[model samples]
Target: MAGTSTFMEVVKAAAKQGSAACDSVAIRADQKSYSYQQLVSSAVNISRFLSSEDLNSSAGNGHLNGACVGIIAKPSAEFVAGILGTWLSGGVAVPLALSYPEAELLHVLKDSDVSIILSTEDYHELMQNVAAKSSAKCSLIPSVPVGRTEAEKAPLENFHSSHERGEEDPALIVYTSGTTGKPKGAVHTHKSISAQVRTLTDAWEYTSSDHIHVHGLFNALLAPLYAGSTVEFMTKFSVRGIWQRWCESYHEGIKADDAITVFTGVPTMYTRLIQGYEAMGTDLQAASASAARNLRLMMCGSSALPYPVMQRWEAITGHRLLERYGMTEFVMAISNPLKGERRGGTVGKPFPGVEVKILEDESGNDAPGVGELCIRSPSLFKEYWKLPEVTRESFIEGGFFKTGDAVRVDEDGYYLIMGRTSADIMKVGGYKLSALEIEAILLEANKDYGEVVCAIIVPEEEAKRKCAEELKPAITLDELCTWAKDKLAPYKLPTRLFLWDSLPRNAMGKDEVVIKAKILGSKLKQNFDIPSEQEASNP
Candidate 1:
């Protein structure tokens, strides 16, 4: 278990532990519970299905290695089965998000070079069209078998051994959000997956006794399942669903039977949850807070968690939410201590076996203060599929991957994520201000603004819009200046503001401020009353 191994090893180990002791709940979806045995059996069936389809095209020639299988099933027992089955058959599993439209789905399938597409009944039509367009075969996931009576049960004498998958073999191909350009596939070897699972399990103390209600996809799901925790999937992330689930978990007493012990979500989800709690009546708020308090852990990541939101959540739930930092390249590297002070603004120290450094700009050296974040970890992705040049440029002289994020270490050793070095780090009047920091302040000042985004506005465009339609600032310039006067330094306040109906978001739901800035700059030139040539050239 300490060495590098394939994901199927987890399934095999659970199977070898005997049906009774290891026969616990694995996945709960659509009100149906799937036992561990049932999950493994379904994986076996999926393996047979792939064999029948000649996915390997190697009847008796040799084992199937490096073959890619695209999985488009909803988060259910079938999804788990597809992944395990792909591993068992010595194939790479590429989990496609259902949120993707047809064009996006086709792009991923063709890019990954999938030989077969595995999907549930709900996605059959869409996936079938995608497979046809991509010239790939589509297969329906086998139904999980059940209802074997006690009298007919056989002794646990012999069972099929797990697939012989080496640690260095590729196991997963996850695509990036395509925020910068086209999405590129990120390859993760079996060893990397194993390392991430071990790190998360050790850090979070995931055990058979724990049941986590998960709202995220990919790494969040795989890492938890690999550690043998029961994952209850809520296909849709409804605020009502989450609160009701928490209430039901503790309806009886302090000691809950089916209580969810762990929870993880993005910052936006937590923000919405906080809003939901605020809207609740006094009696309902008490119940929601108490139920949430009984949970063992609540983790936030994938984006900067606003300090004000973090403070409000602590006030309501009496639990300090653990904040962490991670990306698609490396599942998770930095996390607040499970048993120590969970800081509000800082993402805690690096996990074991992970080394982090900040590379300064002008000095091109490791500095004590703010700089680019570089990470060297065993859990890092092997490469970006089919992008050798891009992959080569992503790392330093050593094996450290440049995270493209700007960060600084505080006196207490907790790392504060300024934001993405390329976008969120804004240069204003010779001073650098973190957009995330300003957004946090703005959110605190104006709760009515559902989403607040800060970007460097083109002054010329503001002048044009102001003259053309008699446009007014969404938040008065004077008001912002006054509100932020004490909270932030003068250099950090927005000298120029761009008001919009909404911020443009990338595929991953992240605001693309860099692109927005360029677009707005062009519009500013068209709209603003141009200054004289000398003035324009000077400023």
Candidate 2:
């Protein structure tokens, strides 16, 4: 229902807006726009195309009959239509990342049992080979079609309505990969997808003029479109390109007609933007800061936003970064209030219809009141695609899904994410520390990376250059502890430190999701300890 557009009745409306239409749903980096009418036309055409491929005669006597349709395309109107078309045809849309390698692509295609791959022309060859290997048919997604004339729109609605999927029917299978595990596809029904967009729309109060950029389908693109907002696509992320767009929005204090009003990013993007801002001359910097300040909303997620970065961005832009906690399974759960206090270092309380529990009782932890965060929400995924056992184990007795991340509530009731239970949590003596909290202070690499309260730190390039110029160790353990002791607890400080050139990241043929800690931890040389006398006292 969310994706459905008023067909023939809206033809005159779309034609009035011209090529830059979606009533301005999406604008590509190159400045091409697709109207809502065009999207509906393309979706209808795609649905018809798929139905002709023997999908209409499937079991359930429905189009596709719940087959998986893998979609490979860059963020564009075509991508949106691909999803809408799959839903219209009663197929589950599996959006495959172009960044995934051949083997990884094959794995996903096979895992989801994708019956067809609707890839864009650019990826047709790649997807075709992969589809062949996976025993799946491959077809290039039709380009976003032109909207029909006023008379034509009336007939198109019924043409697509015949293949309408039920609310309870499977609509999407989003595959989420962690730093150190095989990808797991989370199945989402049409109802769940609708709920995700509605919750985001309600919480964020997305308006048509609130131009936003973020990640994930529902958060970055779908929810905004659902709220009648214009979604912009950047061909590739560029620190300079983003700042210029914000400047264009509010240049020298004049807000452009299509000024970007909302922005979202990870900590790294903000860090780079800060660095880019600092590099600017006083004149340009002032203009950039002023333009950034004009934005109605700014957000950060996908990971924790560091306090230092958050503080500096606020100093420059005058916008407090709204930090949130979410997962691929549910999109967004807890968030700092839109009009209330957005506390730093914590993701705020749950949404209106969301239920969250801190399951400290199950963890048997040394850190009191810290445990896995469990959530039950309307936007919650239906199940893991095909992994019934894993799906069942992921929930608790009360239908609350166990989020493996450890969380604790502050006195003000704000939720502070400690770290992931399997990866980010480290046990030292009688104390358990969050690696994310430590990483926020000190940074890491190589086989010498320690197993205990050890750190493999890669010094910043400037710091490395400065140390190399002086012909000394980049940073000594004494120097680090002396600097870090004021910030971290005694036992929480890294006892063993390895100064490395770089950390082993997506090296050794592993994907980007491979946990560097697991790789580093496995190859750990030894653990070192400091004397009790040298311990940094915690207040």
Candidate 3:
């Protein structure tokens, strides 16, 4: 990888081609397109400003020279430019999520030791306050110029080329999702960035016409840009907008010029999309289904995809979501192949050049086929920022990052991630159980006839609606157990259910509190926030 083209080099090459193909769109945001030339020009301007500020600082280097820069912007040309400018000036880029609350935002700014904050105008005031708290300077990221005439273009000077820095030089620091644990900054080197984009570009067959976005930074913008593909930004997730976009993609058997060819998302997104689909009328449903079917591919990850959601989506759209697995430590490693049979409930084999192993239990005892999943991949992050001991402890023998996930391989070699060792694996009546496995199965089904399974309950909208109409609980302990009898063992099914009005959740949408309670013998209990006067049996 030392001699291979860096991520910047790949992007720059694409930008150069934009000189002749001036209309070649690089990014689409806010209902407008920005060409690659505009991106490069804007990045160069930011790089110059950053360089001059460093030169003016008596003790600072001539350029950023590995200083950390915090970027805050919606998915747009401005965001891309900020990162590029940081790289061109020999700095590390830390992207701050727009969803973060004030306290969480403060934590990231302080944790990353950010020297400067570059944000869009929308967040200028907020970023200014946060940057001051962290003793970092805040600046407005320049808006990238679009559709500039050839004569109006200014030459870029002193821009660092791909060869200026080795692939191992640190490039990006993306924080962990914090779904299972505390968020940590996982630093990725230029080489790792290059590896990920190339790995994804090849694995998914990303072309100039296609658009993808499961991993927005990598899959949508960076990787697609490297492959000279146009990136259309959906800054916010809108059910109606997404469905309308798909419908607009193909109409009357003709592909729209801006039709999306490929897309990726999390399991929650797929579930939402399915909800959106089911809510559509018959004529609109037919159009959406047809458009989605014609798309080159659709994929899901970031959590276990419920079996029923997958089944229903396939029944409607004929696309079996290519579920994959990865984390902040590594952008992506294992996935169901694009062309092969997508096995349900499995996150297919490791990508080419990626290696993985399932480790034995921590108690010096083998647990048959199930164990912690460890990964070693070219795209693996360099380290957890500022946490030497934690970083060292994260990996095991042979440089493998010991992912705390529990997983088992199926007969066909596909990996099924059970869940995090501490967060997901459960010992119920001395039997090992996977909460994720149980959830994927349980979320797909439930029936009621006065009998029940008292599991952790988050009844679906449909269930609630039915209960409202019938004036009876939609699910009971006996009904759940009976339905799950063949799908899950007795020990795996929850004996107690907590049906809260609405559980508090963290930014990553993980439950924050369980509201622990004693389980009395099976008896009828008042439903929490039920739309109807329904009765449910509880343990």
Provide TM-scores for the models: 0.88, 0.85, 0.87
Model 2 residue runs over 4 Å out of place are 1-22, 27-29, 60-62, 145-156, 361-368, 441-474, 501-515, 518-523, 526-539
**Pairs in steric clash, model 3:** 451-478, 452-476, 452-477, 452-478, 452-479, 453-477, 453-478
Off by over 4 Å in 1: 1-6, 17-21, 58-62, 145-163, 217-219, 363-367, 448-474, 500-509, 512-539
What clash count does candidate 1 reach? 3
- 2 or 3: which has the higher lDDT? 3
Of 1 and 3, the candidate ahead on TM-score is 1
Q: Per-residue lDDT for 185-205 in model 3, tens only?
A: 999999999889999899989
Q: Write the per-residue lDDT of candidate 1 for residues 37-116, one digit (tens) a residue.
A: 66776676576566556666653433456788999887788898898888776788999987787888888888888999
Candidate numbers sorted by TM-score from highest down:
1, 3, 2
Clashing residue pairs for model 2: 8-153, 21-24, 21-35, 22-34, 22-35, 22-36, 179-513, 179-515, 444-456
Which tens-of-lDDT digit does each residue in 1-539 have in candidate 2?
Answer: 33443222223234333434445655443477676666766777787787777653645445787888999998787888888788777688999987788988988999999888999999999888888798789998988744445633444435635565676777889887524356789998877777778788889998666777554577778777666677778666688999999999998899887788888777667877888898899999999999999999998887767676788889999999999988877879999988999999899999889998877744475556678889999889989988999899999988999988889888888998876665455556545667667765653211111111335432222111000000113566787778778888887665545443433322111112223333444454233221121111100
C-alpha displacement of 4 in model 1, angstroms? 6.2
